[model samples]
Target: MSLHAEPEIRPVPPRPAYDGTSPFPRTAPLLRTPGARWQLAATAVIVAFPFLAVVLAGWVLWGNVLGPVDVVLAVVFYVLTGLGITVGFHRLLTHRSFTAAPALRLLLGVAGSMSFQGDVIGWVATHRRHHAFTDRPGDPHSPFRYGTGVRGQFRGLVHAHVGWLFAGDSSPADRYAPDLLADRSTRALARAFPALCVISLALPFAIGWAIGGTLHDALTALLWAGLVRVALLQHVTWSVNSLCHMIGERPFRTRRHDRATNLWPLALLSFGESWHNLHHAEPTCARHGVDRGQLDPTAAAIRLFERLGWATDVHWPDPRRLDGRRQ
Candidate 1:
């Protein structure tokens, strides 16, 4: 045969068939099979109860018993728990935006646990999944999932806000949160989530009782600082998944379907997480509020930690790099 002539073609190497199996070992689904209808109903009731109480308090006790103390407590608790998630769970754990000392790591982990959103590993897994398949079918919560019409947007907003949590599907921790899973201390903390939840609820009551020295005061604090605080935090967090995706300025470009935005109104309440467009564009930057006027309490906290030597390798935004990301 001439040198240029093709040799008898060897049987083409069998293409590696996906066969629908992931390269990594499969994990048991995080959520159990659909629970009894009553279980779901109970969850709904529990979630709704806090909001109902907030409404009732506003209606019945706004000026009488709900005073400055209640307002201050609400703001304090909200800031602490909000940062626990934004700084601890989302930035540090999920995105590795900064490095923290062991003490700060443990503190942040515990603080995030007190938020009672979910266990650390579970939260990280769900959030990672959110980024991996943002606004797509596999996304855990996406305001665009249902459709683009008015009615569809309404349904999608609600679903993204809270309904997705009730869905039977769950992000696989092994696939999305291997780093947290490998950390023995964090894994242990995740396993103790139930106890942490109890402590989260009771700590407010205890603090109120200690400060006010009355059952009524304690009860009010529990209502405002505990339940209402949690409800407000939950809604704010959900807004990033729902409202942030639906409205505001997308200053930075991201993955085609990642509809993150900068909803300025939510900045302070969400500890600067409302700068979602920048977040998606630069996932590992510690500061989501990259612009000059953006207010980022979480970034402030991270800066303080760095100053205190509790955090290192902080990834503050670079103007040049951010300029390139801008739309």
Candidate 2:
């Protein structure tokens, strides 16, 4: 089969409105059972190592000044992988906010895989599941999972931010990502995830070595541009799952129990994903920060893609729909 062949689009199954008194239906059993020791260990390493690198980075900064090379590399890689997650994984792949050329689609999947966020198919599937159940039962990660009480909310926030990664209940791609599974290109990209992760680190290291001509410089680049960059982006993404659901303005109304919010503080860092309320209200909209003066680099990138004929059928927001969803 042609790797560039467009796969059939499969619409997500409709979910019932959440009844306040009852839990949403349980999802099918995961590909792996809950709490596999190896998976837990890997997750712990992935989460902890990056944070430890941040601490190391601070110490390095204290002892020897941080170089411009490291800073530039960090920012560049962060934007590359960050947009990979926002524009590629979320908008193009998961939500189908726009249709991209096959080459662009492959580039995005590869870029996103390097972010250490998991395979594209799995990421899309989990996110789709999150939307299917929202903040109610069956949501893979929800800040309200523990309830609204003070202590419960605190614990829920932690769970939503990073604890959910350890929950061990994987979203089954076969169920939630049938379209990607059918696409030969995506399946190949998923298989290359581990290699892409290595390249993510190696590329920074090689660049640092070439530019600085020292092993120390290369190691520092691996730390800042690789581990620290991953940590920052991961936490920013997680913050949306946690803080965005618990605070800030809720100008747009979402489904019952969907407490997504528009948090400006995170707008620049999250590349406008902090405008979470509108996203929950209109999942397919190519633009999340749908207001004057609101920053949405992802949407801007999509606009560029549309102008270049690389993306089509873009789901630009409708003012009527936005007005109807306003709280």
Candidate 3:
């Protein structure tokens, strides 16, 4: 495919006029449809399940303590799948930070699905909408949506952290991610999400079972390496929307009201995603951690891929462009 221009993504317009005669089309500020209840229930399960797994691994179950092998499995999965999100879902798919070879794109998409973060299309659509709106009203996960003040900020944090997901504020794929929506490969991946989810959890259990040949080993791996790892990564990713926006230093300037900030502590774990300030300022730049001493494994991985002839046209940071954004 040819290198294409970044499609302009405009924020959702302010409330369109509606006549009282019939319900006009509009995005819901809060989920109100009957399906909203089911979505809320699913969100509750997703948010609570990992915490439960962690507690069980640490204390609740007698056989739950993870062995060294389990720890290794967890770490490996965390790195691979986390990069799947940061490099594949966020940078390559959402921002088109680089052009990936067909085989590389397929591998990245599948690896990203194994993280259980959602399918590629939905993930790209949601993230593109986020870049389009940042901390503004239409942003599905803005930490400032609830307004100002201690109480409001607290509410905003909660909303951005996880509550916005239950609000059913899904960005339409056609609207925000038409390029991905139009792709045959991506559409196939989106259709495979359910099967991929089962594989995400089951693959670790299979590994543990093969290595240890015991039910206890398999169960332990399923909990710690599977559920616990996914849960931990999920919160780290969500923190970019919640904690990064609310706390970290904004050393880079962005469009007005873009509250993205750089939270250094999460740099390694979030795979450079915590350099939120730089990200919002230059969304398509492949490297988020531009400054010296900033560890960005994702950017390094992209470079490695480029060297191997798997990724091309990577938008490496330009000093002049970045200097302009520095504040």
RMSD of 1: 9.5
Steric clash pairs (candidate 3): none
Task: State the lDDT of candidate 2 residue by residue for 1-327, as single tens digits.
Answer: 111222233455676766543433556545354456676786787678788886888888886988999999999999999999999999999888889999998888888998988888989988988887789887899877677778778888998999989877777788788988998989999999889988999999999999999999999999999999999999999999999999999999999888899999999999999999999998888899999989999999999999999999888888988999998
Whole-model alpha-carbon lDDT for candidate 2: 0.87
Model 3, residue 255: C-alpha shift (Å): 0.6
lDDT of 3 by residue, 91-204 (tens): 998888999999989888988988877778888888888887677656788777666667768888998998887777778888888888788989999889868878888989
Model 3 spans > 4 angstroms off: 1-4, 10-40, 60-65
User: What TM-score would each prediction reach against the true structure?
Assistant: 0.86, 0.90, 0.91
The candidate that wins on lDDT is 2
Tens-digit per-residue lDDT, 131-184, candidate 1:
876776567888776667787788888989898777656777877777778889
Model 3 is weakest, by summed lDDT over 10 consecutive residues, at 17-26
* Residue 225 in model 3: lDDT: 85
Q: Please count the clashing residue pairs in each candidate, in the order shown.
A: 0, 0, 0
TM-score of 2: 0.90
